[model samples]
Target chain A: MQGTQQPTPQPTAYPATDRTVPTRSADRASYDKEIVHAILDEACVCHLGFVRDGAPVVLPTLFGRVGERLYVHGSTGSRPLRMTGQADPGLPVCLTVTHVDALILARSGFHHSMNYRSVVVHGTAYDVTDPQEKFLALDALVDQVVAGRSKDSRPANKKELAATAVIRLDLDAVSAKIRTGGVNDEPEDLDLPHWAGVVPLRKGYETPVADPLLAPGTELPDYLRAL
Target chain B: MQGTQQPTPQPTAYPATDRTVPTRSADRASYDKEIVHAILDEACVCHLGFVRDGAPVVLPTLFGRVGERLYVHGSTGSRPLRMTGQADPGLPVCLTVTHVDALILARSGFHHSMNYRSVVVHGTAYDVTDPQEKFLALDALVDQVVAGRSKDSRPANKKELAATAVIRLDLDAVSAKIRTGGVNDEPEDLDLPHWAGVVPLRKGYETPVADPLLAPGTELPDYLRAL
Candidate 1:
């Protein structure tokens, strides 16, 4: 895992060790590293937000976390990448990942909501300029998508790495919020003529489909079997 | 569905109504209504983007779809609501929803990606001012979460509706991109010793749990049972 580093300027009052800082809304916020990592690891897509042309741009991009740091890669000429590189003060960004665990159907429509675990990280993103760090960051990203993947696959060559730019955003000012279980139905609606409960949602992997052009007798890896 | 309407300005060259949209790069850009609706309907949360104090703010919020319009409701005092109402020419906004279908694990790290369906709508959102339309819009939002739910549940009181503000963003500049099925392994990696394929993701519902305070003899609704 690359790009994972401890936070700088640990607060004297809070003195957080990792990406754990309690929010004003203590009920909905979690500072536990395990809770934060679990939510990020389970989510496959991340909504990356950055300012572009004085307006907010939120794009769905694939991301992977390496401990305390998050890595997002994009084309070298992409709008946000260019903006980040040009901004004198660095580009402010909010990267978020959410997993929908279930849909809560309540007796009352007003109370209907989804059971979700989401992490919202607010900070400044700077372009990773160091070649050695960039290469490791890209590999961390690939491994994030599929665990133990970077080692098993070929690393990016110099030309390929040059073509892709990785942006590093430290995991500071981060907060994770989760809502789970059944709906919080009003007492009166409990007796109402409606079904009330949660519909669970899950993500599963299917049997591996070797590429059509795959050479015969190439065995499946243990990682794919575990999934 | 209240906010599901495709915006009025039609793209001159619409893709054929048939389902043969290619799975690769071509279909990555689609203005099809079916594709847009399917992606939006299946998703429970949307990334709402707006400009605040000249800086971009992107937040994940609940949304619902009507015939041609997408309805998003929030606290009347929220920044997005205030920005849209106060701006001289309204706020430029982007609302996106994505459903991750699978994780594609390729033999090469560079090729690993996700199979997902996503919709991005670019437009200027306006506040819903008309009282009658506001009521209907609120109903549409409720129904969007659960079909036939509005009729079965109680409607919002005048005060509650007044406290909530609903913004309408037409699907005029809407586009949906979907990537499905297995990984696109590099030909050179065909003989590589790694498993390569996709793990399918599914969302399902569990049996209803009656509210803890449910009165005796409350019957479950058929709609929930069907789910």
Candidate 2:
């Protein structure tokens, strides 16, 4: 259900278009959908924030995106999920994902920084009532965690679906900001007696272990093997 | 200045405490200052959420904490910083830090999960005005990244401090939630043909690089060497 519509788009307190200044490098500024989606897809966790009774609440949750819509799932009894269905007004939410690439260990502490890519999406989310859409969204949520693995797993039963709540928010207002490369130190700091440069960081998956009770002769799936 | 003090805390539409269920391993649930501070220090980035014009906004930024207070710095012109001073109700903010320790590659896709540690703090943040306190907070922030490197680098000058806005939020209302180890698949799924176990993830700092313009004869500091 839609709430009262605004005649004109009100300026957000922190508008990406207005505040984004490409001081060091202009190429890092990206509004491309591909870049945004790629960054989001690689991230496994998201921080979802919203206001409730005039107080701000932020929670870490799992999320997946289908096309241009993001779906977040939780127990049907979730307060946020129930709040979305309230008759008064839809709940405004901000969801964010970040991937830390490396740590810039500058010659000087003042220049120390991090190389990361982050995406922030701001919109109002509403509970999904349609069973078909809910099913699809649930599938998308699973697939987001491990590509193609959802198809290999058993689908949720009617009871499971009934107990889960999914909310969808369109990616209408989205922005991605990134910082990369080694530390940017002051020109004079070059002569400083300190180590300077990026200490690259990465996320790697170790060898997978078979479940303790897994049946013999069951081999690891190709999709997971690739990871 | 403290705003109107409500006699009783109003019920939030989406109360975090209601949905926050501690895992079976309750020992992992910590409200200790040391635990909270260590997790916050190791993290290079944080998600900051606040309400702007009746909507929620989340942004990713670098942060550092000292003692029981977290300090976040940004350009003086940043919208969120300005909102702290102008918002009628002050700026209710949520700051969260998360670290993904490993990827649980389960035999069943449904059981796959991640090992992570996340801390969330909810409170109203205000701009730091005392110059002495601001300086110490900034140093603590720098020390958070590399223990003894703050004293080795040039501190922010008066002009730099004036151009930057620092906001401090106490660690009073805070919670840390963690999930670790392998999948919790259904008993029936034990016989399923799939591999299950955690693929541990790690973060390490690479060897430091000297700045291009470092003065001749400058030796690497012990702190940088240790990292």
Candidate 3:
């Protein structure tokens, strides 16, 4: 009966903030909420940028999206995780997820670019302390990896939950920058003898590798079968 | 004739620094130079983290790798690019590249994790100003996307070269952390009904899409065709 509460409403678009706009290619920036969510949901990893002692440190970590917020979990001993739960007022973080769809090989090296969809989210991340919300966020994190996974897996026990730290950052200032389709070669460089095109990149799942100690006759679940 | 001089001798391994070690999962980290180079070379995009006004900012950008240096190019007017060239020494930056290999679904929520290979590099980036070195860096950038692309494409004109800025980060303090194989479920959770396995992720390149404005009779180059 838990985690069956009301769902968060989706916004069609987000308002552009000073940090969200692209300084290089302004035309490629997007403020569409759906676009931002889709990019965040599809990527399995996100680069979390946080300032430590006035220096920038970016760490790659697993992340999950639920409603309008992201849930990133780590061991209680992790630096950022420790900072989030114990630090007052939370820690400012910028999380970004990117999917490189293609290599845009242009006629000139100076024009080479990438066809990618990326989401950048800026906000202060607060520790999820409420048991109810933390439980739901944990569920969302599992389901984010494999849809319907939380229901199948054993829920976190009290001791296990206490050992983990989950941080929540709302999607208030978010932006999606996307570059789709063919190259943008200079007009004068179009007739160059070189090949100019997009080599599209696609991600697919291979056959599953089950644990060596799985009980005999344990069938692969439909959830993973689809992946 | 300038950048064609000496090929950097490949380092057998990188020395571990305090910053490169992982606190929570120390076993997964490695100072192997080969592992770091492989991860960086395979990924098409990198998240470049740098401080702007004392706040951390991470940007997804296309990158190229030379023997022991990484090349990231941007417009001459871009903030980070301008900062590297104008700053007293260079801009302190952390560049990270990651490849998500699989989703590890375990019997318990706390045990769920990802199989990934990621490289984190901490260094100061300086602008490549010498015309010879700059030209070669641009070539490396293009070659990183598609092998042999630099020779096939037209060389950059003086004006185009002037408009681009390339920064070099030597691979001095680099580390690669990789996690592979099946789920690490607890001994007690083995008999749970949930499926425990790894769904491997694979990246493949689709047929190259030709530019719509290509002049008639331009054939697909063998370089892209091979991909």
Candidate 4:
């Protein structure tokens, strides 16, 4: 009976908007949905920007993506969450996540740069009010930390759920800017007797430190072992 | 004659203002100058937020810090850099850097969190015009990527300087927030059959990849070897 509904067709790219397009280095920007999702999913934290008192405020927080929507959660008393609930038109925000891949050392100071992949999303975030959607978002947030984490852990109770506030931002206006490969030094400076190359930076996970209070019978989960 | 001048006394902590204070998790926020500086120095990129057309925009950019000011440089045609030059009273901005040290998996989904250190600076940014200060800031920016890098590379020429725009923001309004240690699972859920611990994340520099056009005699610098 459930098979009668048609699955929504997914678009390959996000349409470029005035805000998503870069004023400089336009060649580095990509509106491809795959690139945007890959960059977002690889990072654990995002810097969220919102306007307060006619000034911009940027805060770093954990975020999770489900399909085309990104969810950020915090305590009910948090400033941005409370503002999102009170604002009728939703709170306008810009969320960005960046991963610095390599340090680009050029022959000249002017060309020194960092190779990075970053995604910036400009949209209005609305408070998630529906209980079903709220629970789903919460699960996605947990699983974002480690795959299959939501099912392995005990779910939130009524009181804990009431204390949290979740905000959802649709990924409509988004772009991924990437700087890869080696440094681009001027042709004249190529012969300069200075070291020019890329110092690659990689993120690795060390051994997990288990809590002292962990139950004796509890074993390390398979999902974490895979990580 | 310069020795007779009094040395500027450094304060141990940054002065907290209304905006730097968080509504929730007040205990996790700190105003110590040393803590703020350590977090900033360890980060390679910062998310710079500014208001444009009455909406918030956050962009990831490379930055450098001197004694009391932070410098961010970009092409003269970049959006924020151009706006800083044109704004009379300077552009109000928020710059934030974050380091995710570990991932905390709790026995319950409600307690999942990340161990992170983040610094948030809110101030007005002005364009740097003086040639001497501009050069100093540019040197600092290069050294921020690699210690002693500016001395190794060719200095920027007049034409290069003309095409670059540098913005200065004072480190006046700032706060650092940190979360460390193990997860805090509910007492009732402590016996749950789930693994709870912290997965430590470390950043490492791999073997330097040299450019094919590098001069034959050029060698990897000692500073990079130290990394």
Candidate 5:
């Protein structure tokens, strides 16, 4: 957390906290704001963790980041959403997203690892109740999945909005960890005669399948075509 | 939990628990063992959630599933690893893995969602002690990333094994939730003139890059070449 940057370029690094730091391999942690946002934006789904019955439960859901705030949506009747809606202080939550970019094949099985980028945010999430903001946040969630699709799609009607639940968590406590590059074999194991390197995983968009019941002349829009 | 399968085909389902069931959208939850194993085997990383000081903390880590047992690795000094290793009963943890297959852009913003498959396991994670089992678990982890890379690579030495920690969790209390196919818009909104479809996301492996210091004339193994 001290002087993370070379001091030659980029802005100041993000402030670190007890929860954000990894007990081992502190060098891989980054509190920089840009790094946190970039990783958050790349992944479409996040793991939301909360305490229930003195035990921890993690659920996978979609999320969108706007500025320093992340908005997550769920069924209005869901436990987390319901808790956030009724509580005065909101519900404490830890949201995390990760992407495994490659498999790091080290010469030794002990050193086998993955090239990944992950972000963890610790904060309280409040149920968003303001009608205007809820509408905007819901739009952001859709656009988060496919840009320009929100505008083309119909806005939520009153009945639909009643069934949906949206919660917002400010990104005050956030940290990103990233691992890249080739295998890190030990000095003596370098000549082990085994092939060791990175097998990169790439995420790409495939052909868009139109709905089977689509009205006969509804062409694929330019926005989807661009995807 | 009651007669989940049809008259024929498939395997047994996990017993339902109050914690495992989704309070909302119960129809999307599946305790089918094959579905749970399929989702677990496909993902490389999982979110491990545990209670620390009566609060929730979730960590993203690599995991491999062998039959009904899941093994996760970490540095010996990591917090979760240390906690699991030192305890007699091990740490109570919830592990979850998710795969987002496609973006479901519905005509209405409320119905916009992602087609995803996810699995959650609630159990105690015990520290692996036996050397033979540890070796096999480590090999399973390597093979988890790339199917045949474990046998093709070098086994861990004594010193390497000493520095690594592995935890095993039983899959008795496991559940898989999946949403697939096209958007389910309301009947009235079906002809809204908006483009709605599934934009699939695919994961592909790029050409493997050999380590810069690889010994000369060391041919790329068939295992890695196939990847």
Candidate 6:
């Protein structure tokens, strides 16, 4: 079986383009789809950037991922959403998500760094037009917040769906950059009396505060309980 | 004494420009200097955006705030840093920092949201040339990662400083948007049997992992211990 096995034909990484490649610290950049997807899924929000009137604008917003596509939703009246819908082809955008895992404190200030995982996606965002696809995107967005949440929450009604606008960006040009492990202090600075180490940052959910208007018989959902 | 009293002349908020205002959720946007500063100080990393080749590009990087100025440092050869240095005018940029406080899960998918504080600055970033300003910026960058860290670590030497490039963006044309409190569900869906509420997210630091080659007698600094 080992000698006769066929070479794998599938591509497991996103094709690296000129835009996705970093000019410095190229060793930290990765095109691995698994690494990219994990970083994207773990992040709660994505900083979306787009050009308006020849100037760059960046905003933080919630996003959901379905396979190789990302869905970002906002009010139909939102400027970015309106532009995505009105543009001839689509709106060029860059979406980035970062998770800081730890703070690397070194003996030298120049060596201070962060242990982080970040994914950047450069693509054209098209407004979601199809009703069925929009519904799926909405469900994915709800589930992205909490696993199994889409089923638990009431689906958006026709009026509600009409009020929301969703833009879809395919994950074509994507790259993940990651830095991990401990402090890297130079030999000369190792004995400088500085306490060098890795201070890990952790994200945790505290007890959920039930809404005052919640139904009397409703119980905390298992999905949230797990968190 | 009452008749002689003079109104305070100092401005407590930033001047909001057209670009700083959100097209939607205008009510969430703030021009208060204190609000913007607090949000910026709490965040460790910021998503910086610039137009490259006529398309928007967003990358997450470490940043520090000193009064009204924000500084971001990286390798001198990095793409954005180089562009800021070479551009005739300063490079136009949009810097955004966001902190998610809680997840709002509602009875309906449409009502789901997040409680977050975010600041966005629209301005041109210029490369820092003055050696004194660069040194201060570098110190602020290190301190931004951990309070009092700049003093604890050795300052960058001449060669190290030469290898780093710092870009400065003034906190003009800045706005902060904040959302807080509980789920905002429609009255008709309040009794829909869903456990709607806010799940608070907390950021914490785990025990510090000392470097393998840390000085034998070095102790954890009080600044880190306080964390």
Write down the TM-score of every candidate: 0.85, 0.85, 0.92, 0.96, 0.92, 0.95
Model 1 C-alpha lDDT per residue in residues B1-227, reported as the tens digit of each score:
46988678855433443222322355476777877888898765799887655555666777888867888877787667766663457778878898877778777777788888888777778888788877787777767666677787766667667878888888776667777767776577778776676666555655656666555676676776776
lDDT of 2 by residue, A61-178 (tens): 7888898899988877766776887363677898988887777766555566778898888788988889999888878877887788677666677777887888998886777778
After superposition on all C-alphas, the RMSD of every candidate to the true structure, in Å, is 6.0, 8.4, 4.2, 2.1, 5.8, 3.2
Ten contiguous residues minimizing lDDT sum, candidate 2 chain B: B11-20
User: Per-residue lDDT for B97-180 in model 3, tens only?
Assistant: 988989898999888899899998888899998899888888888887887888988788999888988899999888888899
lDDT of 5 at B12: 86
Each candidate's chain A: what TM-score?
0.87, 0.86, 0.92, 0.95, 0.91, 0.94
Window of ten residues with lowest summed lDDT in model 3 chain B: B79-88
In Å, residue A100's CA in model 6 sits off its true spot by 0.4
Candidate 1 ranges with C-alpha deviation above 4 Å: A1-26, A86-89, B1-27, B86-89
Candidate 4 lDDT, A1-227, residue by residue in tens: 57988889888999988999999888999999999999998876899999999999999988889999999999999988989884478999999999999999999999999999999999999999888888999998998888789999988889989999999999999999999999899999999999999999977688889999999988887888888
Error of 6 at B125 (Å): 0.4
Task: Give the distance in Å from residue A101's predicted Cα in candidate 1 to where it truly belongs.
Answer: 1.6
Clashes in predicted model 2:
9
Candidate 6 residue pairs in clash (backbone atoms < 3 Å): none
Evaluated on CA atoms against the true complex, candidate 6 attains a DockQ of: 0.87
Candidates ranked by lDDT: 6, 4, 5, 3, 2, 1
Model 6 Cα lDDT, one tens digit per residue, A104-199: 999999999999999999999999989999999999888888878999999999999999999999999999999998888888888899999999
CAPRI class assigned to model 2: acceptable
DockQ sort, best first: 4, 6, 5, 3, 1, 2
lDDT for every model? 0.73, 0.74, 0.85, 0.92, 0.86, 0.92
Give the per-residue lDDT digits (tens) of candidate 5, residues B1-227.
47867676634899989888989878999999988988888877899998777777788998887888999988899988888864477888899999989999888888888898999999899999999989888988888887877887889889879989999999988889989889798888888898788889986788888889987877888877775
Best by DockQ: 4
